[model samples]
Target: MAQKRSIFEEVGTNEVSKPAPQGGLIEKGRKGARKGIRAWLVVIFALVMTMIAVGGLTRLTDSGLSITEWKPVTGAVPPMNEAAWVAEFEKYQQIPEYVLQNEGMSLSEFKSIYWWEWGHRQLGRVIGLVWALGYAGFALARKVPTGWHKRLLFIGVLGGLQGAIGWWMVSSGLVGERLDVASYRLATHLGLAFVILGFIAWYVFLLGRSEAELLQARRNKDAKLFSMSTGMLHFAFLQILLGALVAGIDAGRGYTDWPLMGGQVLPPDPFYIEPLWRNFFENPALVQFIHRVAGYLLFAFGVVTWLKGRKSANKATAGAFNLMGALLFFQVVLGIVTVLHGAPLALGLAHQLGAVALFVAISRARFLSQFPKSQSVREGL
Candidate 1:
């Protein structure tokens, strides 16, 4: 009964809109756009940085083995009363550190060192809790970017392993005649900390831009600068591990001289320690000497990398590298001062902090080399 349509009329001109084809390209823009995650990571980054500084202080103060136990949960609630504190001190007394080094320490003195170690562990616990809460909140709210699930997961795993490794390091000194944690184990623990820090940094960089922007920037990536910076990064990390070794043995307090070790170009009895290889780890003079030589080499390489960075057309990228160069110089000066002062608690902590800043600076420059942001100047209008 409806009027017949005209012969020229279009058929079904208004097509039905099917629900967004069920994924694929339709989901690309909607996925992985959580910018807040980057800020959260930055918070965690700052906390970890502070943790490292506190750890340096703990080592310098000789408070590392105060707890003598790894009660991860129960340890968080410190002794609330004098009796409890005495109980804690009794436990510490059983450890070799207290027996050998702190045999005559009073309960008050024991409490001082105990607090330092306790705070260090408490900081670790806080960091882990922060990561757990943030990751959970983000995942539950569906805010995490695509491809980041595993990356975040890996960090959590590393943190757990780090706790275990920390206990392992502590356990090393609890038995035997050792006065402190094994130098090798300390280096391992510190190296993993840096590794975790580096990953967080790289993640923050990636989250700084949209996926599309990163893809576009990749097209103009400076291969040469990136390559050199990568080398610089590896070299710097190696230097960090070496520095940890020096710290483990209190090597910086060994030779207060700059150009020489107690007036000799090489440290006296550099290989006097037994087992040959043990000298590198246990000998303060040798460890400090190796650290100095490694620093020189690292600085030279940084110079070469900085030169390459200067050639970048992106102003920001070039500036990043220039800053790195300045930090390298500053860090060197700090290290020299730290050594001259016999690695006093304050100066040692400052020097360690300088290393942290320099490492972060180089990392930033390396990132810019890979994803340089172009600067546009208007032509003569």
Candidate 2:
């Protein structure tokens, strides 16, 4: 015989379950929102890289000063008709670069350079818009990871600052007898661009892994290797600024010979120009010589750093360093070719692209040294 249940006892009702674990994460590997944010960052990274290459081309083509004005809001709309084109051309003609260097250039020619500068500026606007929209969407939806809002916001701030710096650079060449922007200002603008790129890259790398994974991996970071790569990163940045100086003064195109300038280890009258200090920025021979020496030293230091990176226990970290070594060598070769060809438009752009690649590689190596990816037996022997 079966026992009868009480009327108050509901069928299939169970006793109280134990409380869930407290003071612990409920989700470890689920970070879809963060991953989406990283994907958006990758898009911005590609845009900024394209902007860099475009800016290089604009400089190589002698088109940087065509706009003669910076209209952050209204400049988005380029010349729409012939009268508008003439108005823009007349504005360019008033600048020293046109009056002294490009005098008698037709409206058509002016239009060509104008488009380049306009395109460059337009790209910047596009990047800013993309960032603003993406950040707003993520923030409003509460998708951004904790502590990331400021970092993301900082990029936008730097980007706006870069726009201001760009105008300041152009303004340097617009007046007086100067035909180009000051080398130091140019270097600042470029250096800031690289800094922004580095930050985005590092953030992207960090976001690639789950927060839990990063916390776990931080325990095994190789301090020495990280330091070495950090040094390499700074050295590489210095080299980039030097390269900008060389380009600013057309030094690369002047000295076509390797291991020598004008058939001597040092060019004649290294300080033939006035002020003595002008030779550092204005003297083609000295600037080229300094750039070459820096390149050599950078290569040597890179080899030492790569060797140290090889000793890292993590395969991914070692592989990143290896790529960095290969890129450094390739960039050196591209640089030599660029010099031999007297910095032709194509080769000059190629060399600049090479520098971009090397910078990203070194950054990646440095990042891996700090937050290495662990490999499992399933991944390799």
Candidate 3:
């Protein structure tokens, strides 16, 4: 027999021995700590940005080949004394970069470049360690959101691949007659870096909001704006790769004039390298010329994209595109200044950082388009 409710109790509800309420978090609450994961990703993002800057410095200073070996673990401990320094310097001398380019360089001079390359490699190690530890800890604690374990793990895998790619890029310069890494390889390495950065950045954005919020926002997405912003992101990445080619062969330093490469509509002797196809990578003028043309076209497309993006019914989406447009315009000016100044250390690094900034901006705009916030009628108006 069950206990029955009184007539007075019937006014509020029927209580015929109803079940007790469930305790603990429901399924939604069990989704894990999104905010904590987002903060960790932000830290990685900053480190990678710093890595790019250090890499640019290494290239500008011609210090990339100073290490001459890829000892992933042992190399972390740099030269400890004079004898070890001499031994390392001796190894560097064997490479064409030192033999043909820096012959008779003093130990002190070698040490300078060695430190830069060493620091770059060390930073890479730190990034890997951070990612590994973060993922492992989160995973072991069962705090990673369901369905996201693989995504977070995929980033670590890419980081490992990046290490291999970094070694591949460095190895090219250690061979016969090559004063630097293969231009294509350098571009590949940098292209992958941006790819990794893109993943991390997108994840950060996604994590900034709750899963429910993102799902609801997705319903309000501006499909056209998303498509346009995706295109813009790809174009910016292409420009970044082109910039890498220019850096690989020091092409930026070769043509110090902007708008016109040395006062010509086109860079002189664009086909100086034989085999026709070889000119695209080995020819300084051709690489820089292509890079310059690409920048102008990217800017033009960005303008068209911006005009469309600013009309979004969602203010947040519009603001993202607006921010992207501003960065795009400023980046163009920065490139010209970088070229006019012969791609010196400070300007060269600044230009690369500018690219990173612009890349993030475009990414943010794309994210907003895909997950636009809903607005009230008054705000929409």
User: Which parts of model 1 have CA positions greater than 4 angstroms off?
Assistant: 1-33, 377-381
Query: Model 3: how far is 296 from its true place, Å?
Result: 0.6
List model 2 lDDT by residue over 1-381, tens digit each.
987889999876676777887643634324537889999999999999999999998888989999888789988998899899989888888989988899999998888888898899999999999999999999898888777889999999999999999999989999999999888888898899999999999999989987778887888888999898999999999999999998887889998888788899878888988999999988888998999999999999999999888767688998999999999999999999899989999999999889989999999998888888988866535
Error of 3 at 327 (Å): 0.2
Q: Write the per-residue lDDT of candidate 3 for residues 178-215, one digit (tens) a residue.
A: 99999999999889989999999999998888777788
Give one digit per residue, the lDDT tens place, for model 1 in 1-381: 987888888887556856665544634754554578888889989988888888888888989999888999998999999999999889889988888888989999998998899999999999999999999999998887778899989888988898899899888988989999998898998888888888888889888877777878989899999999999899999999999999998889879998889999998999998899999899999999999999999999999888888767788898999999999989888888889889888888988888888888889998999998856763211
- The local distance difference test score of each candidate is 0.88, 0.90, 0.91
Q: Estimate each model's TM-score.
A: 0.91, 0.93, 0.94
Off by over 4 Å in 3: 1-30
Prediction 3 TM-score vs. true: 0.94
Off by over 4 Å in 2: 1-32, 377-381
> Model 1: which ten-residue window has the lowest total lDDT?
21-30
Best by lDDT: 3
> Per-prediction count of colliding residue pairs?
0, 0, 0
